[model samples]
Target: EEVKEKAQDVKKEAEVKAEEVKEEVKEKAQAVKEEVKEEVKEEKAEIENKIASTGNYPDLITSLKNNPWTSGDLNTRVKFEDIRRQVTLHEEEITDLPLDKIKTSLSPESLVDFLNMTSAKPTILNRKEDTSYEFTTRDPKEIDLIKKRYGLLDREIDKITSVLIFDKEGQKLKEVKDVLAEGKNRIYMETKF
Candidate 1:
């Protein structure tokens, strides 16, 4: 009878020890899982922060690519149309700004002194008998700078023989430039007729 009791007691102790080990393992697993989650959160945040620091067009594309909606997950919901609308609105706002403001904002280097250095005057002359108009500039460099700055490179000083000039009231003035290779006074245009 005493042997039986001893055997029962040893079995109970072993069972209790096994249960305790299982609990310990469960607790360790839970702890490891939490640590892994924390590490993942930290890494994700680090990557996002790194990307955010690059505030440029390429970074914007990267951010869109990194989104859950773009990761082949059809179930993820995103407001892409709203984002596109906002971008359009911002573009419209930029386009509505005055020319001076746009120039001040986009001028890479201040060429104010260079612009002031030119002593050029644009003149438009029209003769009743002539079929064409005449537009001329004393300093072609100034005209070049103005045209280049305003994205009007199509009209060039040397190449353009005759051009139509518009007044404030939108009247077409006949203009011509006299092509002078070497002279004290450079005449921009001249019409034979």
Candidate 2:
């Protein structure tokens, strides 16, 4: 009878130990689950941030469109158009003017002064009596037009450069977000299994 009672006690002790082990395992599993959830939340937040940053691309495009140099200024645009017409007329006149007459008509001193004012580099032509200066003009009036156009072009280029930098940063963020998202998904799948 004593042996029987001792065997029963041993069985009860073993059962209690098994229950304790089960409770410990359950707590550990809960801890792991909470950790995974926190990680997933963090990953989602990071992805959301990446998406928001990329979403600013449209605003950048709008800012470029609304820039005063590009679209907002009307006077510069009209001036550029007028200069373009004048340049066309001048090009036609160039064909009629004899090369020597054209050379003689343009005063060397005035030409040099104009070059200095415009900060243009003068090409020196080899001549016997008088030094012939050739001013290679891509339509002086058209050049003025492009100068006006540059106000717009410069702003656009700057905006574009900014947007490109933003895009690169956004892309890197997106890649990181993707990796995090994938990791989260893997964790989710593992949890399910």
Candidate 3:
């Protein structure tokens, strides 16, 4: 009878130990499940942020396609739209150059091409505060039109004895004596400082 009692006590202890182990395993499983849930939530949030950041491309491309000014052959329009998207995306990286009184201008088509060419990466040089801007276009006619419209300064360097400055309407603003004969042309004849 004593042996039977001892055996029963031992059996009870083993059952208690088994229950404790089962509870511990259940707690561990719950912790693991919670960890997985948190990780999934974090991943989902990252994906949402990524989508928000880049979601404007499709809509912008659509707008470009529908734009009357940009309309053309389907292939060409598509190429331009792609370039436009790249430009818009990286516009913040392009430096804002301080412009002077000499307003530089370019045709719409040429400007689009230039932007497309430089959209991959942007590198703009910082100029002095009083720097004037001079623009050159491949079309000489366009240059003349811009000069007429914006009163841009004209600098001549081919054995010219004088430099002439003209207003927007071709009126002579000033004529400066060119003392240096090195053929170095200057658009702005005088510095403010």
**Each candidate: what lDDT?**
0.37, 0.31, 0.33
Clashing pairs in 3: none
The window of 10 residues in a row where model 3 has the poorest summed lDDT is 73-82
> Candidate 3 on 45-148: residue-level lDDT in tens?
65433332123223322222222131121111000112323332122232321122222222223222322222122222224422111222334443333333
Writing each residue's lDDT as its tens digit, candidate 2 over 1-193 gives 9999999999999999999999999999999999999997776565433332223234433322222121222111011112323333232333322323222222212222333333334354334432323233334442342223223222111111000111321221110000001111210000000
The whole-model C-alpha lDDT of candidate 3 against the native structure comes to: 0.33
Quote each prediction's TM-score.
Answer: 0.31, 0.29, 0.30
Off by over 4 Å in 1: 53-193
Q: How far does residue 104 in candidate 1 sit from its true spot (Å)?
A: 45
Model 1 Cα lDDT, one tens digit per residue, 1-193? 9999999999999999999999999999999999999997886666555343223223222422253121122111111112323332222333322333222221211122222334433244434533332333446675555445434455433422223332333222222122322222222222111
**Candidate maximizing TM-score:** 1
Q: Between candidates 1 and 2, name the one with more favorable TM-score.
A: 1
